[model samples]
Target: MPPMADIIAPQAAAALLAELVRCPSVTPLAGPAGQGPYGEGRYAALLGDRLAALGASVEFREVEPGRPNLIARFDGPAGSPSVMFEAHSDTVAVDGMTVDPFAAEVRDGRLYGRGACDTKAAMAAMLLAVQSVLAADGGLRATVYVVSTCGEEITGLGAKALVGDGFFAGGRVDAAIVGEPTDLDIIHASKGSGRFHIETRGKAAHSSAPADGVNAIYQMAHIVAAIERDVAAALAAMADPVLGSPTVSVGTIRGGSQVNIVPDACTIDVDTRLIPGQTFQTMAALIHGVLDRSRAARGDLQYVIHNRPAYPAFFIDGDAPLPVLVARACREVLGRSTLRAAPWASNAGIFAEAGVPSVLVGPGSIAQAHTCDEFVEIDQVVQAAKLYAAIIRAYGGAGAPATGARGE
Candidate 1:
């Protein structure tokens, strides 16, 4: 390994972030004549080269047909515990951005571009942290894996593959640190999410004829109203202490072909958030119970509900060594302790389900994610690098916590 002074610097990390912003690795990867590079491969390769420069063995493994996740590992002593730092490489589409999405422009102490805050900033920080650790200590007591995963903005295909397939050869991970914008705070718990569609079918009839056909729109209105009154209220009362309450929102609705005809069918898409101790099955059953009562009352509605898979909510014990290590890193490096729960779902939840204790920590703010003119403060990115480096030194170097097991 190289010496600390010769390893990548904070400025190099920022420059690397600019290079990533220039790739335009949009989700639903599309690469053709006019389209941007596909599967985020361009940016993945760019990151891979940087990792390789720091003596990490890098591999690009396919998660989907064209989309791949980049896995890089820095070796340590034989049989040493291992830890992972993961960040997504993909960004949401830059459809309505107010600024040039790929320019990588810097102004007034900020870097402006898509994926700047949502994730790429954290990615840069983690990379530099690993570089710094390897440079200063030759190796670590724990082997470290720095994963730049793809498809986090959409399907989470990358994390799924890595966790399900044991993509890393370094046995089981002792801890996984997922990077997301928390304004440099530490997140040990988060809500899960589920999506489903509700449809009500009815007979179509001419609008000129009154009371000749069942009105699906009217029926759906009743269902929506019932959900708002019954389901939402019930969920609100059964809140999770850390994640607050589970909630549902009717996001999109469609009905009626034209105003001249009574609609034959109506459909609504719903997003439901889940807190810990709530399973998707239990939530679906509750929804069905409410809808059934509505059906029983009217005895005149025809409706169907279909639910997609749910992302399970997760909470790690706050007093655990991982959080302790992270908090110590923050206090020692940044002179502050910022710990909170994130409202949004990330791959961290999925990792928890796989029995890997995970936490979300990084730079910037979540508000900037997926927004037009999205940017990350330059100072935040630099501080994030320092924080991550401190964590690596504290947990992976000689000062590692003594109480945690491999999967704790």
Candidate 2:
């Protein structure tokens, strides 16, 4: 088979990424599915059709009512390893952007758009590599599932459904390569995120009679400080070596409804970055302890915590075959490779949680992800294609499947 460079023209590569960026796939809000450009259905349609044209069997399965995930399967020899290349179909909100979000413009060799750096570039690279190998007669080495998952930006719903539905045809895929902006490095470990709202309740009263009503907002200040000071210290003591310390931050706060009324309720949304060993249960206990400490100081405090869905932490030992092969593949393509950790999470973690041997890799710098001017270096996208092709080939040739590598 010819090299990917010979098969994929430079313009063709850029054009593919440009086409993906041109689609509007911002993660949708709580609205009717497929009603507008906000959901991933339209983008999934484009990818599904293209993958189908490339001789893959495509399936559009909805994670939500209209938000479908694009699953495309490419056949190989029957006994070969099955590998999944998962690139998210949704981007962060386009609330703040210096460039036109869906313009898909190229300037000074940078492909600029909303999802350009965060993941659309990775998706494009995966598509090109798959296409190149498929063009060669009987050159496809692995059974590949090129999946474009939806709802990865805010919720991991798409991944959850994929796993719950057993999308792998009753057999686990050998290795899953989750695509994110990794500067072409292999990310085997990443911090997960947990989000929840902490609310404090109090009796309402008029401003003139403030002493009669307990102030929930004022009490919540103590809880926030305690979490930052006490809970953070406790979390640091139990930090993972690779992913480092778990962290907590307060994002949005709301208290009194009006100026003159002593508000009966106040809530603060909290975000926590979790290490591998931490779970939602542990996070709740730690914060509950902090809240208890604050309650001991004042008797009138009333509090409740409302939990939200969490993205899991990802980790695998360095010696594992998945990471080893990925590193080798990158080195083969770019003359070097780096295995590292990430503070932010991705679909990789959810796969890891489901007992799939998973790792994160792809083009572009994370600094550009979700930025006002989100863009990916065109060269990096090309490198990503070659890297993925090499990795899939190597994984297929290996005698063993990727499993039993993650630690508790």
Candidate 3:
């Protein structure tokens, strides 16, 4: 069969990306999802139909009401190893975009729009790769599953739901490749995050009345100092070489009604990055420890804490089957392979935690993910399709690359 890379022309890849960009899938964080400007439902439906056209069995499994995961399965030989190509369907809000977020335009070989670089480019490439493979004269090298997940931006609710959703029946796929913009490099390590809110409460009083009010902002200073001075060092000490130190930073703070009145309440948002073995519980414990120490020092300190769900960090050995296979596939198409580590979390961590060996790779650059005028190089998208198809072809059959067989 002809190389799958040769199947999808640059124009087709660009057009598919244009269709995806034209659809507004910026996740509406609140309320039920709908086929509107802020939901993935519209985009999911479109992609589902495209997958169906390629002779894949398509299904929309809702992880939340109106927010569905579009899963497309292409069956190969009965006993062949199966691989999942997973990409997020949601993009960040396009509040201040320089160009029209839904206007998918090709300008100077760059496809400009929201999510064009972040992921839609990868999504487009993956679809074309699947098409090329299926169109080949010989049957598939391995079974393929193209999954577009929801809620990757705010929280990984979809990925969380995917763990035990029973989509794979009692068994699981042999490997998974998470689609994220990595300039086509392989990402095998990344940090997780636990984002939470911290608030300090106090009595409000008129500024003229001396000693009449306790300052909530002043109370918050102790807590912030504890986190920066006390907890930060401990996080640094436990750093991993690949992903570096897990860390925390106070992102936002709000307090005081005006300059005259004493503050009654103050709220601060904290973002914590975690390494392997850290979870939401651990994040809470670390914060709680600092709060307790602060309270001990200040007898009148009062505070409330809310720990949001965490996105787990992921680490796959460079020599692991999936990473190795993807690396080889990258080399096959790009003439070189680069294994990398990321500080930001992605769906890779979610799938890796579920016993599915996973790695991250795709077209475009991470720097352009949420920029004002987001764009991806047209050539990169085409290259990625070839790389993905190469991975699929090498991963199928008795001598496939990703099965992790020790002796064959």
TM-score of each: 0.91, 0.94, 0.93
User: How does residue 195 of candidate 1 score in lDDT?
Assistant: 82
TM-score of 1: 0.91
Model 1 lDDT tens row, 348-394 = 88777777767889988998989999999877888888888887777
lDDT tens digits by residue: candidate 2, 175-240: 789999999989988888888798999889997899989888888888888888998899878868
Badly placed stretches (over 4 Å) of model 2 are 1-3, 30-36, 168-170
Residue 38 of model 1: what lDDT? 43
**Positional deviation of residue 73's Cα in model 3 after best superposition, in angstroms:** 0.7
Ranking by TM-score: 2, 3, 1
Total backbone collisions, model 1: 0
The digit string of per-residue lDDT tens for model 3 on 236-297 reads 88877787788989999999998889999999999999887676688789789888988988
Model 2 — TM-score against the truth? Answer: 0.94
Residue 397 CA displacement from its true place in model 2, Å: 1.1
Ranking by lDDT: 3, 2, 1
lDDT of residue 404 for candidate 3: 41
